[model samples]
Target: MTTATRVPADPWPAPRASGPVRAVVRVPGSKSGTNRALILAAAADGVSRLRGALRSRDTLLMAGALRTLGVGVDTEPSPGATGADWVVRGGLGHGDGGPVAVDCGNAGTVARFTPALAALTRADTRFDGDPQMRERPLTPLLDALRQLGAVIDGDAMPFTIHGKGRVPGGSVTVDASGSSQLISGLLLAAPGYDRGVEVSHVGGRLPSGPYLDMTVTDLRAAGATVEATPASTGRPPVWRVAPGPLRAHDRAIEPDLNSAAPFLAAAVATGGEVLIPDWPEVTTQPGRMLPALLEQMGAHAERTPAGMRVRAGDGLHGLDADLGDVGEAAPVLTALAVLADSPSRLRGIAHLRLHETDRLAALADQLGRLGADITVTEDGLAIRPAPLRGARLDPLADHRLAMTYAVVGLAVPGVTVDDIATTGKTVPEFPAMWAAMLAGPHLASDNTG
Candidate 1:
């Protein structure tokens, strides 16, 4: 079993920080990239090897879903704390057995992407997820499938895809303002459509362009032709994926820069230094916005030979910025904003409500308990520099929320985060990494543990 350091069965008393952070932390592979690669690989025609794929609950759940679709995904147990490598024999065609069934487990990617692949087969494929996923939006993607001539029953999760073993893939438009998953879901499985796929958005604005960029980059690398209209052109974004067979190839996943936010935020909050090595010099990961965003907020960040390094400035400052393109960093930025000398206003992430949880509401409610004067707005949240007191924080079973609250505990006392186990969703090594960061390794373990 490739479990992460054997976590406790009960809620972890989150490790607290005593002083400025000084450590070299290695984050795992990108879940976004891994899940996308898995879908594309499953749709391909040959064997593919994916090295450095994240082995967390989310990515594993994606692998399981692909397995249900009759794709062969073989993973080697991770050795020495690194991510596992996957040997996937690609043949998305139906096996000699019965039809498929996928359990999304609240993973937005699986719930959204797999149905598109199922539409390529004439089998009766069932798609469902946890109760919360049933609440999130999947109608946009489902509507697009219906437009492409796939007979789908039900609007969201707990639905069935009655594929006629052929999709008359062509032009289809859907409003993806709620989440970019809808856009990506269509593009990934488009190659299998008999005529390929052409998707246009009919929404106010797309939420995460970088994520789609990652999708396009991966798709084109796998030999699929993709054309995307510039969103700045005033017309809604349009994507054209030509009909072709995806060429299976080897992929080396990059470290999840988004998951690295909190650990790097440790240095920013305490005027210390932290190094995250293997940082990609050029990549589509949205966390690439860090070098500039942190710099704008009173920190010196640069790409070093070791990795991305950040040194705390004279002190953390505040800035008003629109985080529409890179919304995942909002929670990490909000935690730092509460400690800034000046107030901070984070805008352009209204779609975050449709995430694993209502992030804006959860942030407002949980951070409020920490004595932060935070206001949850329709698009985002506004936080003022207020005297914060350590209070019981509820993670709402969201991994990002748990990681964000843990960073806030570095400056505040008596901050206890409920559902620390939820961090396993993306970063199962979170507890050990947090512990190592606080104790400074060669130091004592109980400093925060």
Candidate 2:
């Protein structure tokens, strides 16, 4: 995700806590999941309803993008409604629709991933976005699009796709080590192409492997044939998607477990308890590693029928591990590290520089403001728990950064989060939800039923 950012006028002063924190949070749908569902539903053989879909900036932008391309999208509750349902009349494969313009709006899913889908249409489509999007990694996916027979005007953001109403997709190889969206964006729309697609990763470590797995899992469930040579099998990765009719059906989107990080971490940081409902026993989401992460941080975790319940231990211990697979949780992890009783080291997350913000650098700067003993590492960070003091902090418009600091505010005092509204990117009602989770007032919760 990329955008030209500015300091918001009203910076939010994160609430200081008086005691142990307890709250039950039902996070909205996964931005990743909702966008993927919208894409799949758009190409399906019939109308599909997405229940429990996350309606936020990213997903809404995706829906808006699909709509501009002539996909029928209707929200049961309302547009941009959190925990909302969607009815989409699709089966309108690309290129047949009229010309369209897409505003990527700092969403990586929309920025790097949609060009391949756009190429499948015989429409004059233009893709444009904010300033930061121009600097994001998109060439890998765009180049792959060109090889697959789509006429593209530029190598990166602000490009145009001249859709032929049909793609002669066959085989394309790309090194998606920097970003998995390159591979996923191509594969998601591959089934619409005449010959389908065979995508092979050239080499090296693929950041966020679990996310790619999630994409593949959902793709298969939608009736597309997907075959892959696992990276763990000592071979380069490759995905073969068969051209076919996508099965349209109603599916309940899962809770955004990644967004559950901060609320869950508040438990670990404050020696309190927090429960995130509807935690899937089996999931491809990398956030599934949270329980393990909680244990490593010296927290007690219980898996019950309701959801995952976590409580802090007598003290937090440091950890040394690679977090590349679960990069989205890095901010929350860093916040915990700053308050741990011992030193901690997190490695294998350098790729975070390419995220919505330069996460690693942003974390370093923000944590520094909070007075943490943080040392920036080339691939990750090292921290020695210190007496953190509250201070005004800017997340640079990064939602993860904003939430991470809010977790810190639970244990510290007078911490403020600038541009807190930026959290609307994924969780629209985050501030309200967090406020509800606090002790004095009320707990803001969403009931899926």
Candidate 3:
């Protein structure tokens, strides 16, 4: 396996595109898919092989967390395989594995998903993360776990799960408005519970429906019976998982469509075209809406044999979008909005406030400093096109922000992203990929699988 370049401590002077760019970018497998697959595989019966699993900080953290709980997660590729293959040997019995501490490292999947797994172990599992992750929401998930008969201490990070070796799982209602991962966490770990679990979302608004759908699909693939009901006009969404044996199933993870957002954005920003090879014919990822979103922004998006191809249209224009389900893609889409010709209103993404950083505030403050007409609304951002100038951007160690700044840099020179290394959180080779896209032609990616 090729190791990614060591990220520098200084600001990254994002390279500018001299003209319209035409390139092919192959991003790593989905972080969401990889993490969920690891968790499912770890909780399954027998050994499973995961091909094209993302090898990034988040997925690594998840593997480490499962390993801490006595599950075997091997990262050795099989013979003739291209990229990394995670071989997970399941059968984590209800043993008193004593005490262990898991470092979440600002990965939402690590922070949100691991707690339920911890609830199944007889270990005194304590979960904590970086300073910023300490501020992200966990109470809703923690409280729901408590309802499922897991003894947990602390409201957020630095919390401990005192498991009695098995969770007395039952129905629990969670306010999952802040994050869909909260609900996914419970569902992923539900099969191991004594009574399985039935989760209901009775919060303000359940965000990221596609992510929840992704979770259900993975669970069903593992032979666990799952029933999901979407929210209606007055009824909240509910998910039910029946206790059963989860069979190990080897599969290839899809390329991260969310990670491909900025590359597509580069095409729109530069009046160029970029092809993302290996785009899945169908996916539950929220980023599946990226091509449609870009098309609305005056970009032509077409799916080919290679993958999804996005090319600049006649001109870039502002968009009025409700990004509730795909809020994670908002940062990169926001980059496109600022450069558009008209005003843009992005609503239904208030939950972004609790992500890696206060993304909404960060976007407003940073873009405002860059002379862009941007405002932080109650739910989203209101941006108007203006003359943007290059400036040093602070991503606050947020990976999305780092990529967002890089997209802006393609159009506006002198843009530097502080802590550009933070992109390692999801896209380990983001800087390299950005450089390759700027150079044009077929771009190399970390995963050739």
Candidate 4:
């Protein structure tokens, strides 16, 4: 077992809002979309351009891994293009060399998605990540690959995929109850396999359904023929991909809606309004459920010309919701629920135990330290209205937990977050963005540009 070094930093005193906070926030491009696009682009037939992709730690790791596999991921903005544009030149047949190392860091996308990509190359690729990553389950995906004729050593992080320059892809059943990423990773690399791929889920209810939808959507956008069917009588859900060429194309990534959770929840917590510009009118991202969830929590959510606007409603209230489909939203929602007038029951998210940290355990421990009534149920969290106090909270190096701390700190003064730097995993400028949102009552950008 590789023991990860625990980096320590001074506690960040989370800023408290005096009154209603009003701002217009523009978050960075989607981390999910950026990483997924990077994978697809690396497998594309020609050069691919990605405009407005997130320049965060996770996306950077994905880009770096692709480059290690002999793919071209460069920063060459078009003649008139603005912001960050990544030009990927594909056509690298699997591995370019042997004995390569891929650092997955703490990004689940890199941990789960890159292994399949590594199997397509004829190189010795070793995948590893932070200490916490070594605990995440990769057996299902690895076993599925093994069934498809891939040589893999080890069942989790710090494993090696001995690429034979090709994968004899065929039908394989995976119990992806742990994560939907396990499924998306296989489909992203399926188009390049010798016989294509067919993935069937034979596990508990799949978590993060929207992420799977996003995968299929991105694959089709690249002109890859993918067919997905839900579970029928006496059958499991299946996704089939035909071996074909993935065309290179330019695409604009949507803003990270998941990143918007804290800011929007901030508005509800402080009895204010936040207008998030460039919010997609239609998106398959799980964060799309935010508006409806916010409305249920006594916040008014609507779409505007600028973007989605969420305003404080009558008052914050607890909610009973099954977050199996949107586990990403649970952390922030848990923070908000603690401040509600009643108790909240957030269920259907057992897989959260396998994330960067056991989010449920962390939430329960940290929130309880702050004098909140929080309990970890079998499948989710039960939070009751309680008086919260300022305390030094540990996010355990989880980005989402750091953001959750920020949301709780908005209404509860004197609270500080430890290891706040973890937010760099996705939103690199989360601290600055959080400070700016509380600095004034005017329209502002999160500096995603």
Candidate 5:
């Protein structure tokens, strides 16, 4: 049996203050959208191509899993060789091959989404992950699939997904206490089943609701019929997707506003100016609420067709907001609260505990080490903004925590984030991108020209 080990945090010392910092940055593509698009494209009938897909560990794992299922996947540089594009030939069927093992490499998205996609194939495939991935729960999704006649091994990582050829899709009530990915996975795999699939929530409150919307949107874009209904007494909210042959469509993934939130928070916390290009003005992404929250805290934010423009205020103030829909942004938002002049309270984040790490505890523990007043409640965090005394931060092996604390370091000198390499799992160019963005006046001057 392989035991799970915590990845040691690598400390990143506070960046040396250069002159006035300003830059227009093109944030990386959305990992969420890219993975969803990849899976949808893989399940579609014809060829679907994606431009500016995030080439991170998680997306790579999805691509590799698709390849194992016999999907023709290719990567080609755009005409100018500036950005990469993916060409995917979809239409998956049962392979006569033996059990295919997939290594998701700490990507909860790929780990959860793949099982449903794998069920579409007649082959027996096993989904496993790195130590961290194993620690994450797959029971909710597995239970839902099992209810639909898919044979899945319960209580194990690297569990076998026995495809019984075709699943009779019917109504399933999924307990989303663990992760919304459970619901998202079932919804993505629903279209390929024999009968239409109807998923309803069971017990726990659904966190990350926007992410589920992203799934529904992508599923519809791939020519699947999906209808979302409100929750009733006995039945949970129902998401119905009809079984059909999927058609291919070229998809351009939206910008990763979740990834961009930290940088935008850094700009607000440190009294700096930063612009994230290609950000969608209207987005279901919970991260889009940052601009309004930042403005509420006295930061200046303007929305342009190009993207979002953010400038820090004279001083930051505390805010109390319900973040159930956008739990992913909770860490960075919590980091922002650390620099506020007053105590900030963030609620409706109980689901944060089940992510890549126990984000609520991890955030409070690490931020407390920096001499900030933080408390992790059952539902969310309460933070008192004060001058954070620079200290070594333990990121607890979570990519979001590591990256979020790095933003904290921008305002508090001498702060360092440990286990920094884990950032590569989601944002590969983190250090270099941060360094280049923080190059201060050099980047600012270039952007001005």
Candidate 6:
């Protein structure tokens, strides 16, 4: 496989071994929440204003997709609005029955969700994306949509979506091993169908299953009826949603706990403490495991009313754990494991290989570049802590890998990450955020623990 060769201008920060890195940082809006809110707002009846919305590439792509489907999305200053909020004037369905092509970039959410919404319209629209996105599978979602009477152009990425304008939703089986996006897509668009969609799983286990809950919760909040059945071996879990008009409710997007993991992990690896303000106490994000996992590694992780506090221990221990649910945070966690006192084995992450890049291999290759002892397997990674002699790191066109390795740079000297701009896919102000956190006082000496 080809690797990213371009070196980043503002590469890894200088390694600091004995200082406390303590600062209270406010995380950006959740990418998952923003995408769902935007889509739900687009399907709502009246104007829906979303606050603290993430203005990243993925959400921006979703916004652009909404506009193509006749939704009026205004980002400019609106009368009596606080902060940089987006005012989405809803009630605009797909118009003119014309062919509209959407370039979702590398956003799988956009690629999956937009097609289902597009199928709800009578418009003959084609959904396309970058080469990587085109390579990603959408056959499961397409098959389910086809079962609902929506005409799809073969089993391809740049396929045409000949919308039936009215979907005859019924029961269909989908393989969610590839992605949970397939399930989320069907759930989001199923509400508007004449006979709401009922989906069942076919093969392999579902990864990131909690994300599907987020989708259902968001849909229910938007006034859609959805019920999920228990999962059984060899039988797909069933989901039933009733056809109805979505309610126009003012919703607050949750803070991204997953996005906050790398910073917390950075604190654990570098003998510092980082505070993330406004982290939700009740969140389904699998990345919430960071605090517990860090504690297991001999760090102190405390959750206060304000937010979360993470402090590094004298010595960190390696952990053998299965992270199938919160697999998105695996790369950074594995990077942090490289600083532990022993070897760490992270299993049940095979789903990660299907993301924007082959995450498992990408993490292994990049960490190996930094002199880390990493072994990439079909299931997951086995990482042994070593004195990571910083080397030029390649981000493999993956945003998570780029951002995760940047955290590795805080504690390792000479670590450089290429294609840093790829972080715009999720966190827009990455290097800036790192710089801000680094300017704070070190937490190792501050015995506030």
Residues 299-395, candidate 1: write the lDDT tens digits.
9998987789887899888868899999999999999999899989999999988888889998998899989989988789988998998787877
Residues 1-449, candidate 2, lDDT per residue (tens digit)? 44465746877888766677777777888888889888899888789999889989998888888887778998987354348998888865443755679999888898766778777667878998767667778988888888899999988778899887788999998988788988999989988888999998985578999999999999998999999888556567889998988999888888888999988998888877788889998988889998899898899988888899888888878878899899999889998888888898999898888887788888887789878988879888999977888898888767899899898888888898888888999988888888877752322322221
lDDT of 4 by residue, 287-310 (tens): 999989999999999998889999
lDDT of 6 at 297: 80
| TM value for model 2 | 0.94
Q: What TM-score should be assigned to candidate 1? A: 0.94
lDDT of each: 0.86, 0.84, 0.89, 0.89, 0.80, 0.80
Q: Which structure is stronger by lDDT: 3 or 5?
A: 3
What residue runs in model 6 are displaced by over 4 Å at the alpha carbon?
Answer: 1-18, 76-83, 92-94, 441-449
* Candidate 6 Cα lDDT to native: 0.80
lDDT of 3 by residue, 208-260 (tens): 88999999999999999999987788888889999988999899988899999
Clashes of each: 2, 6, 0, 2, 8, 5
TM-score: the better of candidates 4 and 6: 4
lDDT of 6 by residue, 189-300 (tens): 8877788989988788788888898888888888888899978765668899998888666666666778888788878877778888777888766667778888878899
Off by over 4 Å in 2: 1-5, 78-82, 94-98, 232-234, 440-449
The alpha-carbon lDDT assigned to residue 147 of candidate 1 equals 92
Give candidate 1 regions above 4 Å deviation. Answer: 1-11, 77-81, 96-99, 232-234, 441-449
Which candidate do you rate higher for lDDT, 2 or 6? 2
lDDT of 5 by residue, 12-59 (tens): 775743543466667777889888988888888889989877777777
Q: Estimate each model's TM-score.
A: 0.94, 0.94, 0.95, 0.96, 0.94, 0.93
Candidate 1 — what's its lDDT? 0.86
- Candidate 2 weakest lDDT stretch, 10 residues: 440-449
TM-score of 6: 0.93
- Cα miss at 113, model 3 (Å)? 0.9
Better lDDT candidate (2, 5): 2
